[model samples]
Target: MALQLIALSPIVLISSYLPFASPSNFSYPAIFNFGDSNSDTGGLVAGIAFPLGPPNGQTFFLKPSGRFCDGRLTIDFLMDVTGMPFLNPYLDSVGAPNFQTGCNFATGGSTILPAKANSTSPFSFGIQVAQFIQFKTRVHEILAQDKKIQQFLPFEEYFGQGLYMFDIGQNDLDLAFYSKSDDQVLALIPTILAEFEIGMKELYYQGARNFWIHNTGPLGCLPRIIATFGMDQSKLDEIGCVSSHNNAAKLFNSQLHARCVSFQGQFPGANLTYVDIFSIKSNLISNYSQLGFKQSLAACCGYSGLPLNFDNRINCGETKNLNGSFVTAEACNNTAEYVNWDGNHNTEAANLYVSSQILTGKYSESPLLGDSHLLAISEI
Candidate 1:
């Protein structure tokens, strides 16, 4: 039976989840995001003074926008569809950012677990939640001090009314896979979820009631994973992804789905929707050609120009010395043709496609609660 299923195309497996455009009036006043590079707008750059050079945001912003992608992220699309302005990073105090609608606490390279000395971002899930709490408190405090500033900060009621989006846990799995065997990493899933739950509970305690959580994507399919582990052909799946890594992601998603289901009853009046990002991304990669993508698993902005085009020593927009010669990992001529952007991130075009899938509400375990404008924007 398993062989028969594996033999079937990915399109067949995902046919049932086809999204339909529906007209609805659902809406949220604000949105709060917590995650890593996948959803980060500029949290990492604002928080730690990190620099993301050009070509990272050339596709959309025409310059680096602190996002890992060449264009907008799924969160950016979500905001646009919902009629909200781009969320201001909580740590960004410059540019007179207006957080009246929402604020993002996500940072690149963040994880659910506590950060180690060498962790990419010191802002772990716990730290992000703490920042959210601080943001909420300060917003109210400043509002109380001056009524005129109410237009710049979120209302106290928006905390409970707004959408709380989560896209973390991928980095946690990446960290686990770095040190432990597959089984050991599997064993750590519960602990990671426990920490995730703690952070959710903290937010719930702080008056957040609507949660939209995205399960981790197919980690094995990432160009970075393939380039790092694909030397062993036996380890690759039928679609050329690292089988063990994807299996781990599947297990994590299952456990996360169950947890989201439980949160509904545990937190009264809370609306929790668990999104199946794995299926969406896996299907996209599985049928990239049919979807109009030229490259499925290769990074558009990477070195080597190989099948995967990834090099650990070189990152997008950074020049590195290889064999005493400087080589810059430049963006490809057309980013829309490729799915992967910098080995780990998606291109703006791919992110838009993924967000369109999400807005369909079919991949969501429960019916999605989105604004009416989202329905219109999804068509694009």
Candidate 2:
């Protein structure tokens, strides 16, 4: 009956999907989310939640999850692991009772800066951050109305009792390169990082401390990107990895890691740690089985034929028995065998595995953190 359960019931009912969520491991009081679709939870699809995605999440939702994948996303797994309630999108009607365990200020395609023109797009990273600031402001203003900040003793320190997760920046690359030049994009990375710093400081200034920063995933491997532009899987770098897009992704990861490390150093009392999702994603691609994933590169549902493109691509959920309008290209009997659920995102099963790795040692294919790793808080 709680909101998190209400949100998760459909996801678990259909597939008995194991999200790998560790609700028992939450070390922080609140969980703040910001990012694109990967960690969106429910920002991008709020407007079009009915039409475009029903076909996408048909298996579970009996409708659309509005998520880019076939099942629960990485954030769902994180909340489950931490023992926190499912995080509601901050912008939801606020009709859902008790909407404050943590709010997702993340819109699907929104950016970091306060740009007026991007509202039409998915919640931009900048836009999402701004929304959080607004939410916090609203909370404070209302508290003032009731004289609660001073009168309410226990709730006084609510701001400091939270954790934040930000996984963004890939969309900037997509939008910039599509419209601007590569050089222009490269130049903007510094500016992007700077804005990111501002957002971090904004959260810190407001009392947020526990933070998990995720790096961008490989852009080159996505089906939508690769369909038109092909990459030769043969070339290997010093690490014996492929060339082209994923290579660029590798480069981005390096820079992202360095930037986060610098941030951790700059922010005082902020327990910020880099998630290295880039590295984890890369490894999933390199060896699917190594990560308990089946297929890393290809989409499980879509046109698996000689002709490949966006129009030809399709997601899992709907059964298109229509004559020629629908054609199944490639599909694994069990999605658990594949990493990618759609063209660009991972399947629910895939997300579970990744979330396990992120939680340190609660669950994972490999050990990445120490047993001494403690939750930032003791109370759920």
- The numbered model that scores best in lDDT is 1
lDDT of 1 by residue, 195-223 (tens): 99999999999999888899999999999
Model 2 TM-score relative to the real fold: 0.76
After superposition, the stretches of candidate 2 with alpha carbons farther than 4 Å from their true spots are 1-25, 47-51, 58-62, 94-97, 113-122, 143-156, 180-184, 231-242, 290-292, 306-333, 361-380
Model 2's C-alpha root-mean-square deviation from the true structure amounts to 6.8
- Candidate number achieving the greatest TM-score relative to the actual structure: 1
lDDT of each: 0.83, 0.60
RMSD vs true structure, all candidates: 6.0, 6.8
| The 10-residue segment with the lowest total lDDT in model 2 | 363-372
Q: Total clashes, candidate 2? A: 29
